[model samples]
Target: MNKPERVKLFLVDDDKVFLKSLEIDFLENADFVVETFPTGELCVENLSKKPDLIILDYHLNGIEKSAMNGISTLDKIKAVNADIPVIMLSSQDKIDVAVDCMHHQAFDYVVKSETAFMRLKTIISNAFRLKKVEKELKWYMNKM
Candidate 1:
């Protein structure tokens, strides 16, 4: 018998308390090898880790106000590996923003709410399923 492999997840948020809480929640309950980053730059720099999923915050409250927001970060991540799934998170629930993220191929856009962690877990599972299916489809197509 062999243990199942843990999912590699990258979580990026500038809010210190919120980020810490999310880190603890996933570490406690999920079979994820989680890496937390305070800024999109840090996350992008570490993209070589090849995370299975990326959860990024729309608003980065870091010292550098010009740092990458979720959209730009998503673009950068896609540039690195278009196959990787990215979920955008924000306290703001603007329809336009969500639509824009969807246009850029975001796996999901989640508003930060009391039930955010639960929603995150659900989205993560769905994204992984989709990704796996996509990979298998690509392989099958190539074989034909």
Candidate 2:
């Protein structure tokens, strides 16, 4: 018997405290192989590592005044590998912001709140389940 591969997650947030807290939560409660990035530029640069999922901050320039924002970074990630699922995260609860991120191909939009971790867990599970279905469909199609 073999252990399943852990999900690799890239968490991109400019707020050091929030980023660390989220990282710790996932590490302590889940079996994720997590990586944290303070700037969206760094996350974009490391896309070659091929994370299974990305939770990106909406305002990535909060600390780095000149850093790429989450939408910009999301665009870059999609351009590199559109198949990778990205979940846009923010402290804002604006509908417009959520809609905009969805327009950019985000798998989901999560607002930072007490329940965010639980919501994220559900979303991550759904994303991987969808991917598995798609993969099986493709395999069957190829067999035809």
Candidate 3:
């Protein structure tokens, strides 16, 4: 894929170590341009910096300024770009919360598991694949 065409991935999580590791993994193994934020606010600020797929953790470490919740962050993000695909990841198995997020328009919900990172990779890949098709269709339509 063209370097410019690589999917841009934004990560919002409290865990710095984990986020960094994920960045390294995506850089080395996946067809993504990864940007990870240790807090939700920074991620929100960077949304306009670039736009693509997003991976959000349910519980963030510093959320007081941001209402300290993933859903709130999601709301803020959607305010800016509703069509951006966001995969919400939570260690908690709160069905209600997941349902609420979905109702609010989350693309997908994932509970932390043994291979959560791998699952994230799959989700990103699938989303990008679909986006690629959509882009091609739009181009063809414009040409026609």
Candidate 4:
């Protein structure tokens, strides 16, 4: 019997309190290894580590305002690895914004709220499963 590979996740948010809390929630699971970044710039800079999934805050505040926002971060991540799934997070629940994220290939868009962490966990699990299926399909296609 062998343990499954742990998923590496990058959580980028400007809100320190919320970021810390989310990190704690994700870390509770042994299957997930969550890394926190205060700015989208930092997250993009560390993309070489290749996180399995990224949870990015849409409106990165303060100093981060001058840096990359969630949409740009998603673009950068896709440039590095288009297969990587990025979940966009925002405190504002706007359908247009969510649509914009989806247009840019975001895996999902989630509004920041009390249940955000729970939603993130579910989305991450589903994303990983979908990724596995995609890889398997690609391999099969290459074989044929």
On a 0 to 1 TM-score scale, where does candidate 4 land against the true structure?
0.92
Cα lDDT listed for each candidate: 0.90, 0.96, 0.82, 0.87
Model 4 score (lDDT): 0.87
lDDT of 1 at 87: 90
Instruction: Indicate the residue-level lDDT of 118 in model 4.
Output: 83
Error of 4 at 50 (Å): 1.4
lDDT of 2 at 120: 96
lDDT for each residue of candidate 3 in 38-134, tens digit (9 for 90 to 100): 7778888889877698899888854354545788788888989988999998888899978988977788888877688898888777887988899
**TM of each candidate vs. truth:** 0.92, 0.97, 0.81, 0.92
Candidate 1 residue-wise lDDT, 33-127, digit = tens:
99999999999999999998999988875556888877888899999999888899998889998999999889999998889999999999898
Output the better candidate (2/3) by lDDT.
2
Higher-scoring candidate on lDDT, 1 or 3:
1
- If ranked by lDDT, best first, what sequence of candidates would result? 2, 1, 4, 3
Best by TM-score: 2
Candidate 2, run of 10 with poorest lDDT: 61-70
**RMSD from true fold, candidate 4:** 1.5
| Residue 55, model 1, lDDT | 93
